[model samples]
Target: MPLWNVYHPVGAYTAQQKQEFAADVTAFYAHRGLPKFYVVTIFHEIPESSFLIGGTPSGTAVRIMIDHIAHHAPDPAARQQIDDSLTRLLAPHTRDRGLYCEFHIDETPRDLWMINGLRPPASGSEAEHLWVRENQPVPY
Candidate 1:
């Protein structure tokens, strides 16, 4: 599974923008072989009074932290592609609004995680494909 934690200042994003962001982020991973259902995106709205940048309140900054199993993007190129895709895909949501944004991805070993009470199959394993097929909850 892939988990995205997106943080932005209050009033910076519309409801539609949040939905599109989630969908787009999910698609980015699905195309890389992860089951769409297992991708998760979270949007956190920070109150203007409480948000700060460079020791001052800022109205236009965003930070996204994504975590997933190592198997999802085993190659550096694949990881780089996701980062680039996120930068391009999120530009309209941030830059267009005069905001700055940053995106980061962290990979965890599959053995260190579990799903449905079971550890996911190793990357590229036949079982991994079967598990995804049986558990996928959305059509790509």
Candidate 2:
């Protein structure tokens, strides 16, 4: 029942919106029996130069984002949900265009840990024996 991580690059996310975003992740994970533990979602606003489609800077980045997410989500149900959430979050923050975004959702049990830290459950030192959850699947 831990929180998942999402690495995002998008448009419209602001400093003030951080809380809402966090809540979004919390709710996202909790929906599936997760406690919405501790998510580390980073939003990277793609600058014009950083974004391109068909050799053109996307004038409507939101659509592009939706499409992109669609391509990544292997699950149809999850695809729609993810697209909807991302689109909703970007709509208010979009400028001339909207958002061309990508989010690496690390909520699967197979994605739980690849720890480099010496912490108890993720250590490589004498405490390595204590490192647990490593054999576990990535928590989604």
Candidate 3:
């Protein structure tokens, strides 16, 4: 699962933009064979007073924290590909909007993750494909 946490100044994005961004993020993973339900994007709107940069309030910065559990880049090339894709995905939402953005990814051990009390199936396994089709957890 790729859990994306987006932190931005309040009013930086409209409801429609948030929905669109979430869909875009989900599609990025779905294209790579992850179940649609496995991609979760959460938006955190911070008040200007509460969001600080270098000990000063900053209204133009956005931060993203991504936790990858079901999959991880297997090598440096794969990691670069992921990073490039993410950069492209974020351009319109951040750079195009004149927002300074910072993001980092943390890969957690797959064995340490679960959904509906069940471990996700191996990548590309029949069970995993079924979950992708069903868009939910099922006993494998």
Q: Write the per-residue lDDT of candidate 3 for residues 1-140, one digit (tens) a residue.
A: 99999999999999999999999999999999999999999999999899999999999999999999988999999999999999999999998999999999999999999898998999989999999999999999
Q: Which stretches of candidate 3 lie over 4 Å from their true place?
A: none
Cα lDDT tens digits, model 2, 1-140, are: 23323323454456777667667655654453322322344444556565676788753453221112101346879767875775565454443244444433433442344433321222123333222223322332
lDDT of 2 at 95: 34
C-alpha RMSD between model 2 and the true structure: 9.1
- Predicted structure 3: lDDT: 0.95
lDDT by residue for model 1 (9-107), tens: 987779998998898888876776666767888999987677787788877789888887735665889778767877888888788778888878788
Question: Which ten contiguous residues of candidate 2 have the minimum total lDDT?
Answer: 62-71
Q: Give the Cα error of residue 100 in candidate 1, in Å.
A: 1.1
Q: Assess each prediction's global lDDT (C-alpha) against the native.
A: 0.77, 0.42, 0.95
Name the top TM-score candidate: 3
RMSD in order of candidates: 3.5, 9.1, 0.8
As a TM-score, model 1 comes out at 0.83
Off by over 4 Å in 1: 70-78, 136-140
By TM-score, the better pick of 1 and 3 is: 3
Q: Which candidate wins on lDDT? A: 3
lDDT for residue 100 in candidate 3, whole number 0-100: 94
